[model samples]
Target: MNGPDILASLRANLAQQVQHYISPIPAPLDVSPWLAMALLQKAIRRGHHPFALQAAATLLQLSPDKLWRRAVSIAFEDIGIADLEIVSLVTASLAGKAFRAKIGGEWLVASYLVERMCLAPKCRSADDLLMLSERHPAYEHLRLGLTYGTIPELLALVRSNAPLPKRALALWYAVGSDRCPSPQLRTRKGAPQTVFDDLCEAGHPHTLVEVAREGFRRSGQVLCPFVVLLASQKSEQPAFIEDDDFPPETMCGSLPSWALDVYSREGQQALRRFLGRNCDTARWVRSHVPPVQRIKFLGDILFAVEGGLLRNHYRWPLADELRRSWAIECQGPFCPDAGEIMSMLRIDIQLLNEERQHV
Candidate 1:
């Protein structure tokens, strides 16, 4: 038959083959559900495949439905853009009533759940981004047209021989911010590449472009790179510690005047919406979302941002500690105190946003 049908047949055959091994399921734990789930997450993060499976099995003994839902949440929040397709795989596996009801459908699903969790690539960038986005003081200023109104003037100045780094951030901001009315990004290999990618390829750092693509793929949201650039400009300390961490700001010395002309033509409403989300809606979306699908959007964003900050800021100092604790390369960058970095980035962006308002 077709590919999916064949795959289904294979899964069915494999499930049957393992049927004898599925009995004597683990006893339901007397532990708190949150605690049990946390323990399972810890195992998964540590790449302890056996322990992760055992935890999933334990949770399944209590409630298959809960296990299934939690698995999806982890796929989004933990795995995230590091492997965006994992969420789709999780959904396809747990999509229907029949699939959920399948070993006559119980424990096989647990096997599927654990296998998926263990195999998925983990990244916490989205989580960190969400957390930072929440408390960023600039959110209010940006929403009120304080930051939105400056685009034309800023674009004009960048085109008029302002530093290359400034030009690059300006061009990237227009394209990456979703404020562009009719964005026509270039494509490479049929996937959309950012307008600033050419500048990136020419030796300028493209962290913003990479961030925008990864964040969008994972959460369907466009990150405002301009916010980051503005934040960096205001901070006396460099946005990145290492010069090579991202492309040098001066890589593109002068942007074409026409590059950002398109944004000037868009109506105020679209810009307002984007600004509102940055300033207002985003603040509560994370904490207020229902548990089942919260990680899908809000959670993914927070984890990814958190992961990014930890990687950029604390990765070196904690390397030895991380090596001891985590077997995977991905684990080296995690920091429990990532909120501090987020606050720093947010405050810089906020200060710049505030400055723009007063000027």
Candidate 2:
């Protein structure tokens, strides 16, 4: 089926599922839409259905647009190859507030998706590869060349037997950097439609391709198509779905500890207070990182440890490599002492969390 037909069929087939889906989850009365988004993704990643549903409800009330956008992104970014059907369901949910109202109402549809995603198998390889393609020093020359390659040439390269990440770079360039802008990459106009059609021609699965197309159309992220490309070659391989280690969890006032991550205003203040203390974590950051980059540096480590903690770890050749790259290159080089620093932070973070709750 073509893109529209595929979505249409999904909408028809999943209508009953959404209509009957029910959750008693209540929106946290005080969560800011920003924290709600942060909580939603992490909750989904951790397979915490209650928190995911609550955050989804809160975000739906506060910012339905961002809620839907976040849903589509996690579908590609976290749940990519593990469950393409769920990805497609989330993609179909992007049909706007009205369609949702008809099929199951906004909250029902949103809650249904959050619950399913929490239970679905997880794979973050697509977003991991996208990050590597852009940031890893090895791709510096490849990035420059692909950024300027002609649409036809880039399209051909996408189908070539090049390395996976390199081919992803070519596919992104073909999709047009202008459409999927990255401050890190030189931007050019891309033929996103042609790129999607070409993937179909290249024998990639239709559901994945269509989800990628609609996902990119909605999110404007290159990770969408990368999910299709990454899954195309690995779907048949021996795959493992194991329970990942749980990230340390603590409560900060009314919200989960993660909601106070460096991005949140509260999280920043807590980190500031945490850093101000006469502690080894503070001393290490002070000596190793510049004064200006300390909070961000620490935040990156915090993310490595706590954020994006996938509860359902999907293992395949490419997915495993991406996980290793994430450990070694993605976060390893930037913060070599991440483990040591995290141990230090754990000791005093509670002190800051307690203080923030009072504030």
Which numbered prediction scores highest in TM-score against the true structure? 2
323, model 2: CA deviation in Å?
2.2
lDDT of 2: 0.80
Q: After superposition, which runs of candidate 1 have C-alpha atoms over 4 Å from their true positions?
A: 1-27, 102-104, 143-359
Q: Could you give candidate 2's per-residue lDDT for residues 1-359 as a string of tens digits?
A: 77789889888766867766665756654778888888899889989988888888888788889899999999989998889889989998888888888986888888888999999999989888887787676787998877768888998888889988888889988888888887668978988999999889888888778878888988898889898888877756889888776555677666777767788877788777777778787888888887788888778766656676688777788788776565456543446435577667666566655645654
lDDT of each: 0.39, 0.80
Off by over 4 Å in 2: 331-359
Q: How many backbone clashes does candidate 1 have?
A: 29
Error of 2 at 193 (Å): 0.6
For each candidate in turn, the TM-score is 0.37, 0.92
Candidate maximizing lDDT: 2
Q: Candidate 1 residues 198-262, lDDT tens each?
A: 42443323443343333334333322232223223333332222211211111111111111111
